[model samples]
Target: MRDSIRLRTRARLAYTACRRTRCSRGSLRELSAVAVLITALSSACENPLAPELCGAVADQVVPAGGAVSVRVCFNDENGDGVSLASRTSDGTVATVTVRGRVVTVTGVRGGTATVTVTARDPGGLSATVSFGVIVPGIVRLTDRHGLMPAWSPDGTRIAFLGRVPETGDTGDGSIFVMNADGSGVKRLTKSISAVAPPAWSPDGTRIVFTTRDFEIYVVNADGSGEANLTNNADWDVYPAWSPDGTRIAFVSDRDDDIEIYVMNADGSGTTNLSNSHGRDDWPAWSPDGSRITFTSRRGDDIDIYVMNADGSGVTNLTNNPALDLWPAWSPDGGRIAFRSGIPFSADIQVINADGSGATNVTNNPEYVYGSVPRWSPDGTRIAFTSADRNNTEIHVVNADGSGEATLTSTAGTVFGDHAWSPDGRTIAFSSNHSSSGFHVYVVDVSFFGKAAKRATR
Candidate 1:
């Protein structure tokens, strides 16, 4: 029965130099490096010398109770068959059991485990192969449309935009919050049309978001004490909290042009930070809260810029002719990561905070940046979406752009708005990968580059 079970790895196969007479990169949209999936009805390669364990096992991202099975067998040119035995290195994350040559692995929790399978012939000769299974520190928090997830300062709750059931594909929703474990979901705001991403206050008591009709609102985390901060007729959106929690930075067209603006925690002391005629948006606060980084088209080209908290000492960091967008500061406040080449995310590049050295980390044109580059909590790695073949996937890379690993290579698209857990062990993002509406999901980053390699890698 084991000999008849065919070996399949994920949605597509990418084989390197091992026994491969041909190796080409997998197509962007259809490839996933998630697991060494099992199929039926094919024989593995024959081994004339001894019982050779055939096929390979790769890493997997399964939910807490999910299960994946792999077929194990030995190629015995000699007619003697073999018996199979399988064991898990860590039973806490996953459990393995073998029945007739099929090894079924069940995920226990949010962790990782390695499974090793041994095939022994009657002569006492045996062969063994092992594969790693990552019961991903991952969870799909929302079953419906939930976008722009923001972690509360205390990391206990996540604030996001929940789509109104009646509105489809309009990118509008009411603000909501849920516990970090995805339970205790509660609605906070009632903005039914075109609600921008929500931002949490530093003290974790309140949230801020913008509406499609050009207004900004702040409300308590429990859905009380709602106030219109920017009760204006002009546009106001893209609000960001300062590191010190004293101020909020946002973009407004009240000046008759789009520019960066800042306001106090309350609805007072509104200040215009970037008073440029060119478009300036996507403000980000440095780790120390001393400066702000944003992207602008001030010089007839889109580039990243940094300025003091008070809107002084403005300097252009990228200065490139290409459209540079989404400037993200490292956790240590030493460097910045942004997308260069095209708005569709051509490449992810990093530059020193002082605007001295700029380097391209992901130079491949195929790995289109899905959104802004997000830095890990330790500032050691960056996560972004890749449209390798126009399939939106979440990927992680070393700060230096090394050790790139494909985390979610689903057949569907992984939308943006990814947020890291405060402890940095998990990342929450939005995706339509499960053949459902866009929902919020989280993946434990424990699988970062350490997971099993895919034959299609």
Candidate 2:
């Protein structure tokens, strides 16, 4: 059975690569680095010398009690290496050095190393190739506080809500910003309640977010000129920017019931979309600005709904008995992710754009309180906040519901709720990241790169 499966996979990949490059049977030998995926297939066929146990062309010998790097090559024409770094069993990847076809692994206590590689074409066809390495423990991203994280478009900076604990009489929340590596912490906003959910504009220059009272606001990237975009007495929260940065959409309760609304870049020309007598909150715009997905209680249960930019053709994309809210549009605009179930026991769920194939990505039943599922710009993964009061952390998973891992490790601090950068590389969220108070913080997920190569770096 394994042999047949391997043969089928190789044949499929060979056929795909052949078709993509218009290569004839004889051209297979002439082409280098065909981007064909090879897993646990045997080497009994042609190229019998190819390494099977390691999933590469050659293997490295690590000295006992010492560490060494191993490199793998997929194509000869592509000078770039496969770059399958070290990964923990939980799916966090460690940083690796790539030199041509060789990847160096450090700190080897002598154990099997397993990693995955991914490649893509212009037509969106991709493949994942897995290989194993022997090494010791690999470092990963750990949570500091349960703060909301947002990555910068370029993956350089993360804007998040930082938490400042009450100091004697201080009871205000602040906004915090930092690099993806959790260094260079700086406070962005100061207030009495909370300044949460700092979302970067497409250019990464301005941020649109909400204050504790649910007033929409924007600020410069350097934490200056914080201005309230919506000075309304009612709630105006969850601000999302249009793909083109010309408009912003958010959920407002100005009409008594929560409704979706859009406004100009400078916070003018506000227009309501849902116009429903029921409640609707959490408006997430598609990458193209053609549609918006949000959470609404219009039906018997809280479900996900997608509507045209003009507020026409509203459709409930998720109709499950379990409550669904906090719908986040994928970067490709093909999927919507949201939190389902009651507050204390919610789970992260995703559905197709047309409201089909809704899957529970995080099947954890250990009181998984989820919120704000954001997709990577590459559309390969989603990040969300998961918590159970005592512990809160940012978690990421493959779009197809695999390779789940945690990003934060801070205990006692509550964390979750976020927005991805336009490039799908960073996440912005609100949390009490530190004892200072509750503030906004950002995290860069660019390090993860892609699922096949996603390991802590």
What is the TM-score of each predicted model, taking all chains together? 0.70, 0.61
**Quick one: best TM-score, which candidate?**
1
Query: Which candidate leads the pack in lDDT?
Result: 1
Q: Show where candidate 2 strays beyond 4 Å.
A: 1-146, 163-171, 179-194, 342-346, 388-390, 406-414, 418-457
Which lDDT value does model 2 have at 61?
Answer: 23
Worst 10 residues of 1 by lDDT: 35-44
Candidate 2: tens digits of C-alpha lDDT, residues 1-457:
5765666676667767787888876676533333233322233232222112234322222322233555554431222223333333322333335455455544333334455544333223334445443332212122433355667777777776655544453434566667666678776766534566678898889878778887888888898878888898998988889888889988888988889999998989999999998898878788788998887886578888889999999998877788787777776778888888876677887888999888888887775756667677678898776766576766778888886655554444545556666665445555554575444544445545333322321
lDDT of 1 by residue, 1-457 (tens): 4443323432234433321544345533223332232231122223334577666665655545556777776786555688889888889888999998898988777776778888777767777887777766557898667887888877788888887554344434788899987899887765445367788887888888887787888889999998888888999998888977788999999989899999998879999999988999999999899999999988579999999999999998878788898999999999999988875548888999998788888877766785889998888999887786656777788998776665664567777578887878788887776766777888878666553643310
* Residue 326 lDDT in candidate 1: 90
What is the lDDT of every predicted structure here?
A: 0.78, 0.65
Q: How far is 131's C-alpha from truth in model 2 (Å)?
A: 9.4
Off by over 4 Å in 1: 1-137, 164-172, 191-194, 447-457
Q: Model 1, residue 110: what's the lDDT?
A: 72
